[model samples]
Each structure stands twice: as structure tokens, then as C-alpha cells.
Target: MALKTYHGSCHCGAIRYEADIDLTQGAGKCNCTYCLKARAWTTFMKPEAFRVIAGEDHAVSYHKHDQAPVKFHCPTCGVHVYGRGDADYMGGPFVSVFVATLDDATPEELAATPVRFSDGLHNNWQNPPAITGYL
Candidate 1:
């Protein structure tokens, strides 16, 4: 099935983008420090599935601690939009989309989808099967 398109942007609406994503593809939750602090629910999609509409220059990248993945955030609002991971792990130049940024996503839509949890806090990132609901 064709993925649905969702619009998203930074907190200050500086960085806007659209993502063609399968709502049923499942989302992810990580217990990592940044994830915890950001309180973000995330999802994965191919790089080609996303399109930045505006404010690309307002985006900043940070690669601290584990430099393998470079986190992208809106410099103006400090909102994390995605992360660019190493080619080996990402299978190419892919980014993990921040599910929280999908402002139009409904709770029912999210509930109907699957979700996976990762123990990133302990650096034990497990790729488990998709979950049927939010964590």
C-alpha cells in the first residue's frame, strides 16, 4: 500500500516537512537520554520518503556520545526532527522520523499502529517485532 503523507514542522514552525509514511509500519520508543529528554515517539522511513519544505538552514546537527548517528534539530526551537545514522546501520542515508512531529496524527491512528521499545539507555538497542499499540 502507498504510504500516507503527513505534514510536520519544528515547534516554532520554522522547519516544515512532509513524510510519506505507512501509519501501520509501527513506531518506536527509546529510553536513551536524548529521547527521554525530548520525549519523542519515533518512526522509521526511507530518506526518499521525506521532503523538507522550508527552513532547512535553521536545522542543526549534533553528534555527541555515539557519533555513529547524527541527530538533527531545529536550531531555533531545539526540536529534534530526525537522526541521520551510519550507513551500515541505516542501510543507506536514512533518517529516523520523529513521530511526535506529526501534529495531525490522531490518537486512534497511532493506537491502531504498532510500536517497538528500545533500551537505548543501556546501549542495548534491540530490533524487536512491531507492537500493536503505544507504549
Candidate 2:
């Protein structure tokens, strides 16, 4: 599970960023309100592992709730590029980068990466949702 730099951006290409992601750790699918609505398929990384390479000003920030992460996206394209959050169980501050936003991930890379599910709708972060068919 070696970390590799992944380039990502928004639908309008207004927000560009780089993140050191270890795909082997698996991408996440959560049934939480926000995640379900966003159809978030993301990879988690330490805050230090992510950096904005361009379009900082064009990135619009949205904080859904106190516990929910501060999400950054492009106002023009409205793509949920990434988000920042803190969870003690996840080892403090972290960034969740949307896999769909990756500008240079090969099909093989994605096929090899695993998918992890969580029951976030019920706040049971440790367990997979009872019905992953929808999430």
C-alpha cells in the first residue's frame, strides 16, 4: 500500500490538487446523509498528504454541519472535489479526496483498489451498512 501522488480537480477544472493516496487502503462508501446525496466514493489521506495546486479562489467551501467536513468544490461545475475533517478514530485531521475527481488514475489502478463500506447513516462507522446495494 505505497502512497502515490494523485492529481485531481473539479468538473470545470477550476480546482486542482494533489494528494498522496494509498489506494490499497480502500475507497470508502458511506450511507450518511451527505455522502448518500453526494454519491461520494473517496479515499482518505492525512491532511499533510494533500495540497491545492491551483484555483484556490475558485473553490467554494461548504460546511454541512458541525461534525460534517468542510467540503471544497468548484462553483462553476459544482463537483465535490474534497473535504477536510477530524476524527479521533481515524487519527485526527484527514482529507477525503473523491476518486471520480482524479485526473490521472488508470483503470487498472482502480480495478485493483478495494472498496470499503460504512454505516455512517446510523453512526456505526465501524460496520458496513446493512444494505450496501444502495450505498
Candidate 3:
């Protein structure tokens, strides 16, 4: 998968960022409480692959529980931009960037990428859904 730089912003343009990603790598869907409410389609990348270009001051962080990912959102429009957590947790130091925020994201590009569903609702990573509906 060849990597490419992509730009994105919150719905209200309060939070902006850029990421170097390989769209061929697909994205993730988790059934966790936060994810179920946010409905964000995300992909993980090293912290270096992500950069917050604007609105750090307006972004709000939410941690559901002690070990949950620190999900960041734009307070103005409530768009979930990304999440960060302990370097060792979930194979971080990584940032979970929501692909829907991409400036140029298209239905074709999304349809081309696979969606892997994780059973976060049950804390079961051992068995994830093998197939899911396209985004």
C-alpha cells in the first residue's frame, strides 16, 4: 500500500489535521459505547502520520473509562477527529484518524477499502466479524 498525505477538518472547521495514509489498508469499526455513538470510520497510524494543524484549543477530549482511548472531538460541531492512548495500548503510539473527515474522501475510495469490525462491546479481540456492510 503506497502512502499518501491527506488533509481533513472537523465539520465546523474548528479542528484540522493531516495524515499520511495508505487508503488500501482499509479502516476499523468498533462497537464500543463511544464508537457506537460517534459512528466514525477510523484507521490507525503512527503518531507521526497524524498532525493537528488547527484548533487544538477548541478540541475536546473524552475518555470513557480509565483505559479507554482519549477521543478528541471538535466542540463546535462535535466531530470525532481522532483518538490517542498509551503507547503500548492497542499497538500504539498510534492515532486513530477518522477517515470520514478526509477532505477528498469519496464513496469509491471508501468502497474500495475494507471495514474490519471489532467486538469492542464485549472486549473480545480474539474473534472479530469476518464481514460487514460497506461504508
lDDT of each: 0.76, 0.90, 0.81
Clashes of each: 1, 0, 0
Question: Which residue pairs in candidate 2 have backbone atoms (N, alpha carbon, C) closer than 3 angstroms, thus clashing?
Answer: none
What is the lDDT for 32 in model 2?
93
Q: Assess the local accuracy of residue 15 in candidate 1 as a C-alpha lDDT between 0 and 100.
A: 87
Instruction: State in Å the error of residue 84, model 2.
Output: 0.2
Ranking by TM-score: 2, 3, 1
What is the overall TM-score of model 3 with all chains considered together?
0.88
Query: What lDDT score is found at residue 20 in candidate 2?
Result: 93
Q: What is the per-residue lDDT of model 3 for residues 1-135, given as tens digits with 9 covering 90 to 100?
A: 768888999999989999998888878887767777788689889888889999988999998797677989987898889888665646757788888899877778878987778877787644565444522
Model 1 per-residue lDDT tens digits across residues 5-117: 88888899998889888888787877767776777688878888888898877789888765446778998888898776755554667767798788778888878877778
Model 1 residue runs over 4 Å out of place are 66-68, 87-90, 127-135
Backbone clash tally (model 3): 0
- How many residue-pair clashes does candidate 2 contain? 0
Model 3, poorest ten-residue lDDT window? 126-135
